[model samples]
Target: MKILKFISVLAILVILVFSFWIYRSLNAPYSHNKNNQYIQIPQGSSPGQILVKLTSEGIISSPIPLKIYLKITGTGKEMQAGEYLFNSPITPLEVLSELKSGKLRTVKLTIPEGFTRFDIAKRITGQFPQNQAAGEDAVLKLTEDISLIKDIAPQAKNLEGYMYPNTYNFPRAVTTQAIIKQMVEEFKKVWKPEYADRASELKLKPHQIITIASLVETESRLDEERPVIASVIYNRLKKGMPLGIDQTAVYIAKMENRWDGVINKSDLESNSPYNTRKIIGLPPGPISSVSESSIKAALYPATTNYIYYVLNVDKEDKSHRFYSTAAEFERGKAAYQTWLKKERK
Candidate 1:
């Protein structure tokens, strides 16, 4: 009887010690460092494989305790596969919860208003290594799929202005074509059917309206000023005068792959149709990605005879002064030139 009692006591003590160890392992934070950590749980990874990965990534001190705990809790088969981002010093329970949630990691990409396809391509290529391997030229070539916007912009050479500017979440392994397709789809969603009628009223095609909107987007930063700027563009087009927008010169530089963010004298004198300084009418295509407000401004221009505008030097903001006559325009231009010289100095 004494021997049996001693054996029972020994067994109970071992069970208690084991249970305490399991509890501590489950609740204790496990990480090599306090910095943010990321792990990729490839598709179709088994629970054992996932635990091994966690151990290899230094996310867990040891997988044995976690494996035992998961098995005991009947959650061993609950782990899902995807890339996971974790902050260090996270508990095993938290890590398990994250894996089960299956919220794979994504790249947050922001395409700002007035970004050109070149700009967007550069951003996409730089953000995703999978895309970078394909090269920026390959990404830009993907945007040339005219079928993406054929219904809306029948005359469009490519999906330039139609790539609506917005924040997008792309997976790590996303392709360039998928990114452009989604952006074009987003543009389609914002384009109302009534805009087609408005374009017709302006005697402009959808592509032409987008081209004008791109001009407005690049020309002015103020929302209220967009309509007036659009009016200026229209008035100039109607009067058979050069638009004289410096941004168009910038656009010409981008097209010739010589854009260095500075508009030189030669760029202004370039004979490219995109150079509004030398061109008589609208450009052959959109110059940059446009926003809805810019598009609306293009569709509904303000009633004004103003044909020229210069940056307002007096204001701290990026505002402009509009003028109808050449003399008034020259005055504003002179003021701008003086300010530019002072700034350069």
Candidate 2:
């Protein structure tokens, strides 16, 4: 009876010691030397391999305790693979939770509204250089794929005005093609079915609406003035008059690979269909990416007799002054030219 009692006490002490060890292994904080350094666990890596890599990189002190805990919890199979940045003084349990969630490091890329496809391509190439040395020109070619939006805008020559402009976060290994697809998908998401119905009510196609929206986006920065500017475009189109928007001339210059930041006389004289100064209608396609506000403005232009507008130089917000008569337009032009001269000086 005495020997049996001693064995029983020993068994109880052993259980208490093992339980204490397991609790400390999971809950205790371990400060390591590797903090803020990214460690990539390749795809298909086993849990044992992950633990070994982490332990070897000084991200953790030992793998034995974690291994035992993982076995007890039946969670070894749930570990995922991705780029991880572990902080110092982290518990083993916390690390396992992070691994199970598969959180990855990401980089941000921002495309502002009204950016042209060329501008977008340059930004993409600069943010994510090609591993195969396929330069910026190659990235531009990726934008040329029209199949992505064929169902929405079959007449679109390229994704000029369709790539929605916004900030995006992506993994470091993301491809440029994937980035472009995501932007287009975002644009599709913003374009609602009611917008298409509105286009039909205005006797316009989706392509034409997008083109007009692009023009409105580039013309005015103020949301209040966008609908007004859109009205001017509509008025000009109705009267069979040249739009005379200098931005179209700029877009032509860019298409010809000759944009020098200066609108030369030759640019205005160029007979390209996109040169609104020479053309009497909307451009063949969109010149820049369109914003939702600009699209709404195109669909719902305010009712007005105004057919002309010039920069409202008196206002610092780059607003415009509308005019119904050529005489009034000429006066506004004179005032704008005066302001331009003063700004140049």
Number of the predicted model whose lDDT against the real structure is largest:
2
lDDT per residue, candidate 1, 225-306, as tens digits? Answer: 9999999999989999988888888877877788998889999888888888777899999999999999999999999999
Candidate 1 off by > 4 Å: 1-35, 56-78
Quote model 1's TM-score: 0.84
**Candidate 2 residue runs with Cα over 4 Å from true position:** none
Clash pairs detected, candidate 2: none
Measured against the true structure, the TM-scores of the candidates, in listed sequence, are 0.84, 0.96
Q: Summarize candidate 2's per-residue lDDT along 1-345 as a digit string, tens digits.
A: 999999999999999999899888877888987677888888999889999998998877789888988888889989999888887889988898889988777879999888999888878878775524877778888899999999889988899999998999988889888999999999999999999999999999999999999999999988888999999999999999999889888888888878989999999999998989877899999999988999999999999999999888988888889999999999999999998999999
lDDT of 1 at 227: 97
Candidate 1 residue 218 Cα shift, in angstroms, is: 0.9
